[model samples]
Target: MNKIATIDTRLWQLGIMAILLLLGVLKRDFSLLPSQIALTFISGLLTQTLFIKFLNIKKYSFLSTIITCFGLCLLLRSANLWVHPVVAYLAIASKFTLRPFGKHLFNPANLGVILGISFFPETWITSGQWGADLTTALWLIAAGFFVARNAQRLDITAYFLMCYAGIFIIIRILWYGYPLAVFFHQFQNGALLLFAFFMISDPMTIPHKRIGRFIHAILVAVLAYIWQYWLYWNQGIIWGLFFATFLVPLWNILFLAPAYQWQPLSGDSNV
Candidate 1:
């Protein structure tokens, strides 16, 4: 048998996302057609391939493209079939156009989702679409944790979740006298958990240094809380991450670390 060590973190992420997509479609009414999913992958991969060829860049990988497509499928909602493919194309295109210091500036799926909702008001994300089921939330947390661990970015996810939860507890329960159950109930949100683990934890877009990642996580959490609670805006987490990404280049300059690679180096495990 082949050694399990040969697998890439991207492969693990792809498997986990595939399972989540299947579960969402089969059980949660994900509001996407099979054809739409197919179109997303096809368009995303094709865009990546064309960009690689057009730029004459050798040794390009499609793993990121696949992950972006799955993310878009999981988060983005649309009334037309063209929206998925178009967004997928634009997402992949940004990887090439938006690079600063040889790294992609924004998380591809996050940018795509933000642009989709911003430009096309009809296209929106359903944060509670997966329903607040304890069993499902637990499963997502476990699976997402495993994936984040494999990717060597679990610290950011942990910090973000803790900080975000702390803000909610302090404001909603203690400051406002809301019931403690309300604090616990917030954990049942599948979208919030998914965003914490999958979207914001993307290794490529995040800062390379540990301190940078932690500071970035705290900034995102605080911004998300203010946007959602204080400003009465929806999808605060998504918008928070989007805005915080603009500072990534500055972080990289101040605290430099090696860029993350999905494929493991010769004897190293973490990438």
Candidate 2:
């Protein structure tokens, strides 16, 4: 196979997520506990394995579980240890159970974040885990853009960023008296970059067609803006993606395309 088709993009995701977790723990003073991290992986792995066996699904693989575990460790913070494992379990379980139109409706990590924040009072998301440092922001954008490019989902990432930044500029900057620096500062947020590159770029959950992906990105941006700006709520992006997930089936219906499937690398037997 050509090098492009030989690459496993999920490996890049895992490596980057591991780096983020390490950075958060060592530099950002994240509240993520060791026990929580351990349990999160164990729960996700076991859940994925069980579902694969019982459901007779030979198509799914373990990289998605590992990626989800890393995402949980990076984005989720909880005072309670059990919250991590439970959310991890449900997130993986949702992949098997929540298939609408033969495709998973929500990104597993995204769903895990939603569950943690919604069901557990002590759980929360930490944008500060990656921090607003200039170097860090640049690194995040560069790394994420590279990953999205390799996965051929750079269009969706670009569209989402453009729509989100445009909304901020037109409404919050040009319309109001806010400085352009404010816009730049908000883009420095790590959570937004992570969501754009990793969660939304997942081939399994997003739309299969180009136009559908474009519209989906717009929906996510608009819904997130409504939640944060109009409704006066925090973590709008997370909730925005959650509500937007319901319409994925609609996108598939309107667009009439096959669901995305991972193209396994050459000389690799796992499917």
RMSD of 1: 2.7
Cα displacement (Å) at residue 137, model 2: 0.5
* Cα RMSD for candidates in order: 2.7, 2.2
Identify the leading candidate in terms of lDDT.
1
Using alpha carbons, what is the TM-score of model 1?
0.94
Quantify all predictions' global Cα lDDT against the true fold.
0.87, 0.84
Output the lDDT of residue 94, model 2. 92
- Where does candidate 1 have its weakest 10-residue lDDT segment? 262-271
Listed per model in order, the count of residue pairs whose N, CA or C atoms clash below 3 Å is 0, 0
Which ranges of candidate 1 are over 4 A from the true structure? Answer: 1-6, 265-271
TM-score of each: 0.94, 0.95
Report the lDDT tens digits of candidate 1 across residue range 192-236.
Answer: 999998889888889999999998999999999989999999999
Per-residue error for 239 in candidate 2, Å, reads 0.7
For candidate 1, the per-residue lDDT at 260 reads 76
Task: Give candidate 2 misplaced runs (Cα > 4 Å).
Answer: 1-5, 266-271
- Candidate 2: residue 194 lDDT (0-100): 87
